[model samples]
Target: MTLFEQSGTWRPVDRAAQQVQTLSFEMPEGVTAFRVGLEFDRSGGGVLDLGCDGPHGWVGWSGGERSSVVISEEWSTPGYLPTAVSAAEWHVVVGLHEVPAAGVDYRVVVSRATAADVAAERRAQPAAPPVPERPPGRDLPAVDGMRWLAADFHAHTLHSDGALSIDELAALAVSRGLDVLAVTDHNTTSHHAHLAQVGERYGITLVPGQEVTTDRGHANAFGDIGFVDFRRPGRQWQRDVAERGGILSVNHPLGGDSCWRMELDQPTAVAEIWHSSWHALPVLRNWGGPLAWWLSWGKDTVPIGGSDFHREGSDALPGSPTTWVLCEGQDVLGGVAAGRTAVGVDPQGPVLLRVGDELMALGADGALLSTFEEGRRRIVGDRVVLPAAAGPWWLEDDHRCVLALCL
Candidate 1:
């Protein structure tokens, strides 16, 4: 069944000069194409610029009103089709000329066009069918024990900037036995439906989120269940995420010259310390020089890592040194909210993770332990200690570098 609906407008609000609107949505799996519609009267006019965020670069142009801008049509952006966007948060910038004329009305619509075969198949299915049973031998241990509970929050796909498809990403997540996967596309949540579809088929939790990126830097928002317009800016959007019960993360705050300096000034749950595929971004040279200084000052902020893979030739890889978050139990959303997430070389690899005083350790076989007491590491034991005090504990692993946190 299709998990997305096409055609919608921005929340009714006043427009002003140099104004920005950010829209957030769950670009579920199975969506192949999408269209965005903007409707606003041309008044109080100067020039209106229209642009939308994409995987690698931004699209559309900020120019006059009354004309429609096709976001993904023909060679809109080089090497990328103006169709089939990855699932994640998306933002559209409607640069108003001279403040919208009083009482002017404008709305934006995003639509997806599916091939006849997929449409026919979709018509044949009732509501999402009962998930197919898993093949034998696939019955594995709890994902938390296998260190599959943690995963990278930032990544891309062929839908936009990344090279892989939604199905491929899910396969990787499932093969890794990830309990939760956050599909963060560049600027649009078009791929979310596909993530959710494949995730359910594979028995995993696919959280909806977006990478609110700008020419300056990028940020990610997880746990969102509805359409969030990242196109609208200000604390209201941040507040909207909180109101919707989502986790907000500032991505790769230390990346480069274009990196956003404001993440340091705002309050957020986590930050991306390691974003792989940096070599592909020649435009932003010296991306790592200032990261160390920023990290030193923001040690208190949670650290999450990702491959930041977009497609091939893009500045991210499928699993090149990604991150993971270890949740003690289900409720993936809760884990992210509690800062029980981790991003390192490989979250699924056998390793231990220590965040501040809190720690979590994973065994080569995927067993997990939480502790803070400095003592001999325990392995293959039946008895596990629960925290007696009110604070985070250590996550340990004998093999990999303390992979992630257990909050």
Candidate 2:
């Protein structure tokens, strides 16, 4: 049965009034399940984000990825959390992400779900794919009991705008030979509940993360810390994450529309200086842009890399430009917090790492090593070690294209 329905035209004036608008409805008694559907003029060149809030608090948000969501006591949509139905006031929140000058018409419908409907929806869910055979692990060396792990600090699943589910994404990461993957869906922690179970099944570590997204900038809050509110300022994100025993990293500071433009009193400890987008151009040119930004922002900021993998063909695959973290065990976040990270073109690509009191250059024969203190030195062999100096070092090919980076 139809519970509530609303239709209206959203103009630029409406968006100017408020980016996010909420409509509320009182739930009738004895309704065990509900579904919310949002429809808008697709060809009108407008973007609308959908989410829900129960009397308790935030339930879920799918940005502009999903148009409809179902919730009940037994199951919920991939991006939503399941909650028991009760007679109370609930809200549908709409974000006017992009509104055309001419305005766009939209409609939102909330309906009651019967048991048969819920059962059929559950039956239609996809099954997990067969696990793929992962490649052999690298034999990179480290100090005493520490080891270097291959990781990618940014990725997504269907919990947000990503194409794959949590299980499918984990399988893909394992197949690409990544030891760790951070699932950073935009503005939501709905995926965190399944990370551990899926990671164990795929034999990979999945770090809990949420991309605190806004029109001005985006940052990744790493750890199992609860949701970092996206509606807050960027500085508050840093403080909130830190106070909760987590770390925050500025993501893709130079990314076109998604760049870091928000003002902050201080910069985060880590920055994604090497992103998969750099692979599209001459490596040195792309690397230099972010390097200059980082130098100006904060020279001491630790550098990291991410593919920002969302779908198969959209972004580079996970582990393309792998992040190598040196840690005692499966503590990728700990390694990142300690500034023990390096980036390579891929899982098996040339790499420069700081081992003990020296530098280790693997698979980087004939490349030039650029460092902060020691200007430049030519690497003669694939496995070459030299006396360490002030770092933020990288290996560049004769064409001036960067092959690897170390922090």
Candidate 3:
């Protein structure tokens, strides 16, 4: 095996600027596979979009979502071509976006394997785990003839940069106690066809959705609708998704590198009020983009949550902050459309429920809570019963952190 590793520093780049960091490596005979891993500081306002080129050209590209990938003779990561990784010089290109004034730093590791090593890897790949049938939505409460369905509306699969296949995702979702899982791959709906089989096998409601990932912003489209055109304008996506009876959401509008910077004069269908990124983004960074935008549009703007689950090593899960949707049937997207949903801290955590003029917590007792209505929110303690008219406010933790969005 041959390996090369190095640490490099990148100067501050403008909002849209490209930077290149190259590693020159000479290969010995009989090398069968080449793998690459790029690690960087996602905090401190530096987000890198990366692609690599071998002696030939175009090894792979994992935009922000992935930091490592393996390329073999016949197959590579999706969005990349798997061909002969000829022995020669190679280059890794980095697109620096949203860099802080202090500059960005990164580490690159490239490794090559022999035939025996590659064969061992093939044999070592674990077999897919069995997915158990899902039980009735776990820990959910029935409110006014509506049962709150727990769903993770944003996730990816091997069809995109996700490490898990559809089958693996199903198994993981079942283990995570999710009743619904939406596989919203980046810019493609190719995974939609397999949802029925996979979801049925796992006994969970599979929601078909697509992340219209673009350079400007990102959105999630959910439904049985066909492929959505990501190259189209944002308004077109909203119009087309609505026409197809699907729902759309501006995801992580205030995220670091994945922030939704696009401006569409038309109203947004929904907004990701609580994304897992909220807790992890750099502290220096302003994490109030989507909330500010939603407030600008008033409380009518439907809100949801997505962990954007791609893997397990990270603290993020399919429903780290579970989305509880009020559904008459098992249709999770239908609840999203009707704006009868609230985002909670976790599957087993507190979920604020609004039944008529009364406010209550489901599965949460003595948890710090608050209330939000109109554009303003006030922090309330562990008090269970909210006064009348205070009934319509979102529940927040101390420091106004989003505990459960009752609105």
Those runs of model 3 whose alpha carbons end farther than 4 Å from true positions after fitting are 1-127, 132-139, 281-290, 372-392
Arranged by TM-score with the best first, the candidates are: 2, 3, 1
Between candidates 1 and 3, which one is better according to lDDT?
3
C-alpha root-mean-square deviation, each candidate: 12.4, 1.8, 7.8
Residue by residue across 1-407, what tens digits does model 3's lDDT show? 33777777777643335343445666545566776778988788788765566676545456666686666776555534565766667776555644678877888787875556556645654466786655455555577687877888889877576888888888888887888888988755557767898888877888888787776788998887865655568888888887888888888887766777776757675788788877654561234555566677566777788988877887488888788888988967778887788887778777776665766665554445543434543434433555446322555444555567666
The candidate maximizing TM-score is 2
**How should the candidates be ordered by lDDT, best one leading?**
2, 3, 1
Residue 260, model 1: Cα distance from true site in angstroms: 1.7
**CA lDDT scores, all candidates in order:** 0.50, 0.87, 0.70
Q: What TM-score would every model get versus the actual structure?
A: 0.53, 0.95, 0.67
Candidate 3's error at 328, in angstroms?
Answer: 2.1
The deviation in Å at residue 120 for candidate 1 is 12
TM-score computed on alpha carbons, candidate 3: 0.67
Model with the higher TM-score, candidate 2 or 3: 2
lDDT tens string, model 1, 182-273? 77765555555566667767686766767765544567877654434445563545677778877677776666653655533365756665
